[model samples]
Target chain A: MKLTTTKRLERLNERYANGDISRRSFLTLTAAAAAATGLSMPWMGRALAAVSEVRFDGWGGVVQEAIDKYAFQPYTAKSKVKVVQGTFGDENEIITKIKTSKPGDFQIVHSSGVNYYIKYVNGGFNSEINEANIPNMANVLTAMIEPFRKITPKLSAVPYDYGTTGIAYNNKVISPEEAKEKGANLLTDTKYAGKIGGYADMTTRVWYAALQTKQDPNSIQDMDAVWAKVRETRDLAKKFWSSGAELMDLLSRNEIVVTDAWSGRVAALQQQGQPIGYLDPAGSYAWMEDMLVLKGSPMAECEELINFMLDPATSIAVAEGQNYPPSLDPTKVKLTDKIAALPAFDPTGSMKSLTFADPLYWAKNEDAWTKQWDRVSKGA
Target chain B: MTKGWKLYDQRLAWILVAPVLLLLILLLLLPIAMMTVYTFFTFVTAGVESAVLTFDNWKEFLTDSYYHGFLWKTVRVGAITAVICAILGYFPAYFIWATTFRHKWLLLLLLIVPFWISFTIRTFSWIHILGEQGLINVVLIRLGVISEPLPMLYTEGAVIMGLLHFLLPYMILNVYVSLESIDRTLIAAARSMGCTSAQAFREVTLPLSMPGLGAGLLLCFVLAAGSYVTPQLLGGSRDALFGNLIYDTIMGQLNWPMGATLSIVLFVLLGAAAAAYSRYMGLSQIMKGLSA
Candidate 1:
């Protein structure tokens, strides 16, 4: 195919963005082509200027604080490109926002892993990332990236960190021994009625419910039993928190004795001497978070930012600060003792110890299950 | 020119109202029209609706008892809240209107103070006052008056309490403005005709203030019924209003077609209520209350 001047320039730009060609080589080639064609490119300046700011939305609180402090601040200092930040209490809330907005209005999201990745892909909001651009994916665990890759052959997101939605109990009220003994059933224990709490999310509610009903979350045979268990807990719960900050406040203030909580927030509470005990029950729900690049985003800048975030030192700092295990392969990259000791950390890097939701299995039932959960949660 | 520019001339009136009319069409009518169109679209999945025309959304809504139950509950709660506001609000408004104090404006200024703070923060403040470890519970526990903390924070009662806190000011203002517009000499005239103060108030003051009270009730009802935040923050899961239902459908379920259907249902329901009030009592009273 004969390449038009515009197509040639576009291909050259993509190559440069993907780090396939060096700047000097690209400039030399472009100058030669310009001289041969006897024309100057008018769109080059506008294209370069378009990527000055990259919009990012994430779950705000300590997690975003860590990212902003360790990754975004240093990346901004180095690249001179701003990372504008927004926050959402729920992933669905952000998806709704994106749906209402025009493309490019939201560029990058701190997306919940493969399950949400499927939603974005289904909604046609995903962008194909040139793996060549984000070189630091080498250090990331293949176990984490493979899930995202399964949904889209060309990945739109890079897995960043992992944690469990474990049971967090007020140690003053419930003994650690009792928490371990009861396991996931503690959430539905009548003894903690009117004092229990849980995450107000369908996946978390259903996952814990599956465990309580002695069914596999990824492939539940008895959804009726699972939902019954959810309603049982809902009856017992004092409140179902929607955000990490609310979770912390509920735990710290002694408003709730027990709840399924984010492992990192539980760790933060423990560090603060809040008498919080975290127990990742057998078959606890393990989930991963990813730095997702949306369609119409400035690809080069986003890839550069992800690369900066994945740098070992930066990633470790963020992991330590956020109290979640980084997605860095322990064998490939040396991690700090703090990150290794964090909740849900798999030192062997095989990721066999943690159980994750089957994205396809869950995605199939997401619409129906979510609607029912919303109803059951409201005293259906 | 004078003949053409008569005050009630249709062309002059249209020109005068055109900017606001255009703004109303752009901001209000256009969004509602779009939402109405969306209600007919097919919901493919979460965040993936199709424009293929279908009546599935409306059919589901019409057949569903769940939506009906929530709508009934919202209206019930809103009515209870408005009635409570009118009862609780009237006395304070009467006190302000009949006060012998020279600085009457100070009382009205105090009424406006709550609006200075963010509404969400104000709603959230109730948590600190009503939670298990909150002020009332802690104080009661310390005083040896209560053995355990009451479950005051997350209940239907808490939702009503929150609505009262938010809607009371509107009621007070409406009542106060109506009371202020009353002719004082009429009360004096009734008293001079051998009527007791109470009888005078019943004959003159109370009858005159009914419009304000009615307007306040309507305003409170509409605002409370459409509320989303107060219930989400202060009420239990079961205390979710119709607005919360619409929010979950749109924001949680990502079912925009159904969400829009729910939304249009609420819009029509609330619009019908305002229309009924206007048809009976006239909307001018509400305008007078709001302006004052």
Candidate 2:
């Protein structure tokens, strides 16, 4: 396709931001150029008018920041394809659009866990991937790919990174022995009352609840059974955090002694000298985030982007930057001592005991479980 | 009344009003129309639709006592917020209106300055003042006045506090307009009739300002009822109001049909109540009161 007016302007704007062109020159040239070329501004600026622009729907906070820094910036610098990052990771918003929006509207999506894969993509809103285009697939850990394949059966998504839900405690406050004793129950124990933090996400919280109740984490069909254990620890919580940033803020302020957190987050904080400790507990959850290219989207380009993400150096940068272990094989990229010490960076270690979330179960019973949790929403 | 201009001149009037009407149709009417259709359809995961016309979504919502409890909880939250906003707003709005000081506009400006900042940011600001190891707790701890941090942030009280902070400005503005609209002559006349200051306020000023108070009550309650942010940010698990329920259903469960059903239900319930209220007050009277 010929370069649309929108694409030209976007490139021009990007050049301006990069200081490649002076403002006066850009204004003067674009004005003269538009008049000469019979191209206009207002109408062409709309997203629908642009073709070959890869739409990225990514995570918020650290994940987004890291992706921008380590992946998007470098990829855009090298690749011919123009990527326009839009507001994303809002599953509901995306789900609504899945039906109404035309094909190729969104080219790439990044979200954690396989729930969406089972619930949405498996249900039919998906596209196939050519692994050959993503040559770096050879470097991707088999463990990482297994979860996606297990959930969707035909997961068009490539595993980008993975992490686990565990007890993140301040080593200075709780000490190693106390944390080991409390294990997954550290956040629920009365001894840590008013100092424990909880997350509101049903997937992680339900898994935590399952473990707390001594139920088989793999089979969490009974909503009542889950809520029963959740209720036992409800009063022990200081607050239910809404975001990763909020939970991190709670810890940074010395507000929470122990909180349910992603091991990757704790590792990130520790590197920043926060003295955060992550314990696997007797039972916990491991989750992975994937990059999906929708059917009728610019697949070849997206496959290239995923390949770039899976590249050995890019993968290592993402692992270090986001503090989540890359799905790529560790042998391909060397890790610093501090990063290697993070359990998420070495998934094959003690994480065998932790149960990976049952995505199929969650996809089926999300509504019922949501109501059950709503019954005890205020764990205060 | 003008000789040249016809009251229902289609060409001229429509030309002028077309933009607004078109905007309303596209932005408001279109979405509602779509939602009405979605309300009857079945939503499966993955954004797939069955095209099967069904009332199961509506039936499920109506039959479930769990959802009814959410409705009641939302009402309670709205009532509490509206009442508190009215009470708190009255003193300040009255103070501003009664004052003949040269800087009265400055006081009003100060009242509205907080609104200039983003509402979500304002809601988040409460966390520092109310969290366990936040400003208040840190101060108290340093002073050795408390051994443990108080649980001030994540409670029903904090949610109400946030709602009041946001809704109070509207309430004050409404009440201030009514108070300013009250004829000073009436109060003077009441005083001359052997009435005390309290009696003048009760008989003259209070009655005249009822419209503003009424408008404020309705506005605050409606806004607070639909608020999802303040409660989520401030109130822990205990305060998942109706908006929260809708959000979770749509986003978490990915159940659009049920979500649309809830939306329609909320819209109908609020609309019906507002209609009843307008009928009681007379729509003209309420509008006049708001303007006043």
The candidate scoring highest on DockQ is 1
Please list the C-alpha lDDT of all candidates, in the order they appear.
Answer: 0.92, 0.76
**Deviation in angstroms for A259 in model 1?**
0.7
Question: Which candidate number would show the highest lDDT if scored against the true structure?
Answer: 1
Instruction: Compute DockQ for each candidate against the true complex.
Output: 0.82, 0.41
Residues A1-380 of candidate 2 have per-residue lDDT tens digits of 79976688778755532334544565666776688788776523432232355788876678778887888889888985677886543555676666567766776788665776765564566676766667788877776677778765655888887778888998898898888887887867887887888777766678888887777677865657778767766777777776677778888888787988877767778878997888887666887788877755655567778889888777778777888877766665555564576565563533354466767666677666665675576432
lDDT of 1 at B199: 100
How far off is residue B135 in model 1, in Å?
Answer: 0.9
Interface RMSD, prediction 2: 3.7
The CA lDDT at B221 in model 1 is 98
Of candidate 1 chain B, the 10-residue stretch with the lowest lDDT total is: B1-10
For model 2 chain B, give the 10-residue run with minimal summed lDDT.
Answer: B283-292
Error of 2 at A5 (Å): 28
Chain B alone vs. reference chain B, TM-score for every model: 0.98, 0.91
- Candidate 1: which pairs clash? none
